[model samples]
Target: MSKYIPGNQKHLTLVDRIYIENELNRGTTFKDIAKFLCKDPTTISKEVKAHRLSDWYHKGTFYNAKNFCIHRYHCKKTNACGKIILCGVKCTSCPTCNQTCRDFEKERCSRLDKAPYVCNGCPKKINHCTIAHKYSYNARFSNRKYRELLSDSRSGVNLTKHELHKKDRIISPLIEQGQSPYQIVTNHPELELSVRTVYTYLDQGLFTARNVDLKRKVKFKPRKCHKTQISDRTVFINRTYQDFQTLHLESFTEMDTVHSSRDSKKTLLTFFFTKEKLFLAFLMNRCTEGAVRLIFDRLEKRLGTYGFISTFEHILTDRGTEFGDPEALETGANGIQRTSIYYCDPMRSGQKGGLEQAHTMLRMVLPKGTRFEFLTQWDVNLIVNHINSMPRESLGGRTPYSVALETLGEEVLNAFQLRPIAPDEVNLTPKLIRFNS
Candidate 1:
């Protein structure tokens, strides 16, 4: 990119600067360089003169390189300090000579007065030219400064505080009252802002309503795409959501996994009962089909076969890869059917939305991207106890623990070791679980 074709773009690009630097080193005249770039010769001259930087590498190699006296060559004085006899060291080469010399004249570069101002085309090395100070132009440095100035050249906010406040007043209250950005913009035409813009305003902290207030938006990602090949597609045949709807079971549990981070292998398997609204989680070394099946086997052993069948008569979960093999979970080792397994439709996590909402409680303690490698099953149980004990308006001001105790029986609750946390002591913040320990 020696030169760009002449166009309406006025600003000098990085390529133009590089070309100018190379041309100056080859002693190319400013007029010829400007002719190739389709810019005025004076524009090129001003650019080089304004952005040249001083070369100061000598300070590291030579300790006494601070000498900037114009008469350093002819006037040779010794013992710049107050001494009767000469100290036998030339003042021109002394470290403190510049400070003591009363007639110290600052050196200036006369060559900078000519057409090409920078030292990029200088024939002498930097060490020889340091006496009078040398300056060079670099393409990367000049381009970076030009971009900073270009950004600053633009003006401040187009809207005033009053105007912004007016929009915020209309948008924030409705958003906090459970309305989406799309709904606000469509319902109130006076906003004159796009849904995406409203979301941006929220992100920038320009409004009172935050991203957390929009519960559904912050709880789940917009997309969950899995492009892996299905080794066995026949596993989803009769166990589809359609087949489960025919049974019309009065109560069921939704199953899902919570990832601590994408890169970490450790994960948590969660179970949310639809009727009792009780949440339970088990930490695993990794999220795998075999791990999930093993957890089911452990749960059956802990609850007894008959108790497990009564508690989990029918289970509905998403089509996650870890939940791929359902037969291992449904059939016990003694060849008895414990519980039926069903899968939600593809891309439909909302089918078991009761569990999806419960995931938020988990995220409050362990946000996305948190490392779960150090956590234990006891830590998971502690988190579940606090979550199930919190009072909810949907449950008529009663906690999930109280409901589970009566509905699922006290013996099952005792086996699970579920307890109630005081209403005032219910801490849902990230401080509840310390990952550092």
Candidate 2:
């Protein structure tokens, strides 16, 4: 036998069961076997009783002669046998005799009724015993049964239909009202369903609403490639993306132009602060170099030379024709360097990726193919304000407006007309802009 270690109360292994079977076959007592195995005597006793198999004959008679006699209560001569008067003659255990004994009756072993429930480790000879009752342990059978039970236990949800329906009632309405699962759980304290579970249920069509109804579930078209327009007369020679990286500057702004399918000439010039995630939008009459220059000049006049230089110390943009006039963008009204402008490599708009990602939020409110011809600078400002007010996970749940207010101060937010909206009221849908109009 292996040495027993204390405090090792884990589930039995096949090796342990094999050892137990060997001890039983050797006629070892349950207590002695348990002591050697470092398990309680009752655990050994229960293990035998729970796993032991039984064989039954016709009319539910156990195959054992003792059990068979115990089930023969309908036998005819009740008091004729002399043995009946003395002790008991439940049955004629003779194999030649037919089952015609008048006082036949079965008996149960008293030892099995107490402890060590099975016949395992019995000292009696099997051939001498009339009772066919036997107990033996098989390691392979026990291990297979254990694995099957474990798998069955881990297979299903424990929620009742009533509980699931209750959760669905609370969640379905919020989803249909255009609230994201994340927003619903965050806003409602009583909802017990997790955001992931809600999404899973939505995907499974368990809810009344589908994923297509969700605002953010809409698909966007892939970005098209624009041909690179390299020019010798352009001022990009000194202000390449390589030049921008060499400066090791902490703060810079990414600029891009957003066009509408309804009007070719009207567009929105957008600027994003990479570090703070602050975004500003200016409505332009056309997607032209002169229109972009006019917006920059107006911002310089509004912020003054010092404020403009401090805020827009470096501007990184793609090689759009509207931003092709890098010289005009770099020079102030006094013919001096207002701020440096750097151009990304041809066909690599991802070089200014911050603005590209920020544009997704803008596109949520003003989707592509929407007419921007009727929109004004104030209307664009309103849309940008709401976009900036949304909490970003990357910002530790702080809105861009909040971060900019702290980093760039109230003066900058006032200059851009950016204002913070209540967290719950920060809408990112076209309905908001339409309602404002």
Candidate 3:
């Protein structure tokens, strides 16, 4: 469906995402949304399915506890665990029975599996809806997910074999005719490649022309250290490390980003819940200010205004380019002040030493230079589950998940979908997630 898309089309902006969300809620068709957005129907279909999240309500009050078993309503069988005397409850009443019973089959709503692919536009009343899991397309979440995907897709070599061959046909001939790559690109601007990129392709042996062919290419050595200046000089008044020290806050969340390599666009936006000793990380394709804002939006959406404020009372982070916009991080989407953000002193990563220590454990699973391109949020969650499950000496041998549960409670933990893995089952190695790459 996307094969013949309009050539000049741009990505769906935040406004477009909001419009899609509103239309979805209004029971609009994918074809209609696609036509309105100037996108293919398949694109709309894929976006909705990819970014839709399960909606939640207070269990047993407005919504029933999530039970998806096909036999949940009619099953009269007791003691599916094979201990009829010991386990007196019916199998349907038991939470673990679904895992234990061999006859257990999941029941899902067909409407959710089809074209619309979410419960947002369903005709059935939300309360009366029998689907075990309810999913809806949220504008904010979808927008963030789309940004991450766009950034990911843009990373690495973007040209296909056909495109490369076509360009090579144009470039290789010019190089053979004693014209430099720069001259060739200058002569024919239709190639649409940078002179440095053409050189890179030659160096990588993708083009017929090699470094040997270019008279001066092989003479230069690659530089080791490239220094970058601090961007966006919006002086952080009263939000500095000194100011944070004056506050004398009891607990705060320390935030940082973990990179695979200096050149890799993929990064992990990490948060260390200091009080709970819990570490959470999200996979971001690009470490940009907009990406950081999206993450804040996601958290705000999950925890609400007061919950976010209370939880992330004070956030201490470094003055990286990605964290330039402090106001966006501190302010909620609904114009409510959510939390305070503080910047650490230059080169003082040890200020947030607890989070640095957490990074050590994170390195155990994803060693330095591990490409994060193949990892999804699910993979990140799996890694977090293992990292948080391990017993920490600082927490008096208690796992971070346990301490977090005690301090933050189950409701808050559910907001992040955090679950503790058994200590014995936890695997902190590259083997944990067998990457497709």
Model 2: per-residue Cα lDDT at residue 297? 96
Clashes of each: 0, 6, 0
lDDT of 3 by residue, 1-437 (tens): 46566731576788988998899888899999888887988778877888898764434422225446777878887887786677667778676766878888877777677978877777774556655567888999988888888899887678999999999999987787778987998989999999999988897899887778787766888755423324666657888899999998777899999988766789899999987899999888898889988888998889888888888889999888888889888889889889888889877889999999989989988999888887899999889989999998878999989998888889888888789898789998888888522
Which residue pairs show collisions in model 3?
Answer: none
Candidate 3, which segments miss by more than 4 Å at Cα? 1-229, 435-437
- Give the Cα lDDT of each candidate: 0.83, 0.76, 0.83
Provide the lDDT at 353 for model 3: 96
Selected candidate, larger lDDT, 2 vs 3: 3
Q: After superposition, how far is residue 22 of candidate 2 from its true place, in Å?
A: 99
lDDT (10s digit) by residue, model 2, range 160-256? 8787677778778887888889998888767677888777778777777788878886575545766535355457777888988999987799998
**With candidate 1 superimposed using the best TM-score fit, by how many Å does residue 313's alpha carbon deviate from the native?**
0.9
Whole-model alpha-carbon lDDT for candidate 1: 0.83
